[model samples]
Target: MTRNKGADSVQSEASAVNAPRMTDKDFERFSEFIKREFGIKMPPSKKTMLEARLQKRLRALCMNNHAEYCKFLFSPKGLESEITHLIDVVTTNTTDFFREPKHFEMLLSSVLPDLHKRTNRPIKVWSAGCSSGEEPYTLAMVLSEFADKNSAFDFSILATDISREILQRAVNAIYSEDKVEIVPMALKKKYLLKSKDRKKRLVRIAPELRKRVDFRQLNFMEPFPFRDKKDVIFCRNVVIYFDRPTQNRLFNEFCLRLVPGGFLFIGHSESVSGMNLPLRQVAPTVYQRI
Candidate 1:
């Protein structure tokens, strides 16, 4: 009465489809863990969304249902292997090269010149939550342009994300041609390399610029591993997922991590008003460390 291998897989798929929707209790378990471990708020409204996202993982693991997935996710084995992946899946990493263009304009106009004048040391810029490498590579091009003009100006870029999966994408520094259209033509000409296979329509950040950025995995919920303070930090659009207290604490840490007179760039849609942090609003969604 044993089923054939194909029959077993078909039955498995059917059972997975017929599996009960994630229960209220299971959703709470996931939401609580996400909030505690990643500082990401997963309200009840996100239950359906979370359920959908995790379904793929079940298939990958050959799991039949949410219960089995939850069992493994809470186990110690999951902590080592699945925790970060869980966090990664829940995130929607929407980013673009040269996004919020005003920030770069400010970088060229004030942040760069000011920081460079303050010290002869290589200017340190950290692109927190840098998704798929756009922000950091854009930085490389702009900073390189500035250095060409000012022989004495030197800089370093640190780009980090919570997802190892996304960090790998950043390190690869490759993008579809469309992913880079926002990049200006002259800069694109200087900093992007076309794929050998033209039909693929792919481009990679020039090797020279790729060498300038160091990509790493960083979770805001963990202690920051900075050995030296940063001169400028771009954490734009990242704190919105955190609750107010988490956001406050995270910014306070960013405040402490910056050298005085350093810059912090947040998302245009986000605000830090009324927080007692030592930052002054210098432009729309841009702040200077006091």
Candidate 2:
């Protein structure tokens, strides 16, 4: 006998509403797996946080309990398809336009000029963990403006993130008005397009600006796939999630991909001090590959 469609719908809705909370045992398993796979530390303090993030996944998978979700998440099928989504849910993707304005100031005054002298080739920049495209788009605008005043100054940007969903949003290049408020009016007017309908307080990056940036998915734990080395890498606020050993390993890997004297800008709150790497501090939280 076939089940009634209406009853099935009700049952599913009820199951979601009353889904079981993640148990401590399950959280422990998840924390260990996440740290081993992604290099993200998940301490006991974050058990509630993990539980909350994983709930949406359970709902999406139509699973009513942690047991059901965990079983699928570990299965071969789920590893192939659902793992990306799980990674997306777990990672925090906070970003803003022109965050840490001093970095841009240093870029324009010091880094750009140094690179321009070397060759007329477009300066290559990589924005690791670029969330929703704000940081890279900001970089594009900054670089474009700099190119206008300087002769033979051009650049390309590569924005990468571990989260597939956020990368897609970054590709869309759409943002609410408030999201771009911190952006200077001059740059916004030049690089962003207003929505055709005035009723919607949304904007999109200008086509030229959007095209200048290439968005890709990258996991710090995985081997980086790049044929050419980058001139500068902006990996701000991302390493804070990893443990000390992981951070050191990732930074060393970045150094391997950077041209000698290539600049690295990290979040002001993070430091690369005490780690043995082929880098020297040039400015606050900024280093040059040696």
Candidate 3:
């Protein structure tokens, strides 16, 4: 008995196609690159997860394996465009309207009320790491409601994220009906427009609310460029991926950007623990700049 030559050739090709060939060194280099460039910490335990996420990019670029992809990524030309794709692939954009409702409740109940009473000047809110416009739009809806009653109170939102792709989506201001389900009926009616293509199940945010939010591409690793300090900064669920040192640096930056006694809202799972930052916990997951 003997093996057929054609069959042997096919088997060899299949094995090469399906093989997991990302070396430990390759993983280490990519991990370091992510941490240094994006402030995201990818430990050894996340190697499998990182490989899985990057596999799609490898296929899209017609690369055979992670090693080739890594080389391409660091190449001069790849650094310009491929790095954007890499960040888009590596970062998570999981968000919904009114996510972590308690924060919004606190904003309306305590933060906004106190700020309104403090001064008659315009209010500034920064929605850092605002993915897909949901958070900022939600903020706008809440602020709009307050303005409707007060008449004289004015506010504006700055929504920023590192991923250009996500920022574009946010500017489009289109969302699925399911994405807006958490929005209260009155607010949804006021702020959302039912798309003409009802079959597509899409909703576009009203121009009034959309215009209040200024969406921009921003990397948190860089210095924030704003002349005016914010009355509130919403950086929720964005820094959970960073290590403690990175978190500390980010919190300090937030403090510097915020007005004295301004508010900072983070994810429920995140904290300012172990860091003697200039922020005091005013509510669960809510901090005020000192």
1-290: candidate 1 lDDT, tens digit per residue: 97799999999899668755898999999999999988899999999899988888888889877888999999989778887679778887999999989899989988898888899899999999998888999888889999998878999999999998988988988899999998999998999999999999999999999999999899899998876899999998999999999999989998998999999999987889878999999888889999
TM value for model 2: 0.92
- Candidate 1 collision pairs: none
Count: clashes, candidate 3: 0
What's the lDDT for all of these models?
A: 0.90, 0.90, 0.90
RMSD per model, one decimal:
4.8, 5.4, 5.7
How many clashing pairs in candidate 2? Answer: 0
User: Which lDDT tens digits does candidate 2 get at residues 154-190?
Assistant: 8999999998899999999999999999999998889
What lDDT, from 0 to 1, does candidate 2 have?
0.90
Kindly list the per-residue Cα lDDT of model 3 for residues 149-224, writing each as its tens digit. Answer: 8868999999999999999999999999988998999988888999888899999999999889999888888777
TM-score of each: 0.92, 0.92, 0.92
Q: Give per-residue lDDT, candidate 2, residue 97.
A: 93
Give candidate 3's root-mean-square deviation (CA, Å). Answer: 5.7
lDDT of 1: 0.90
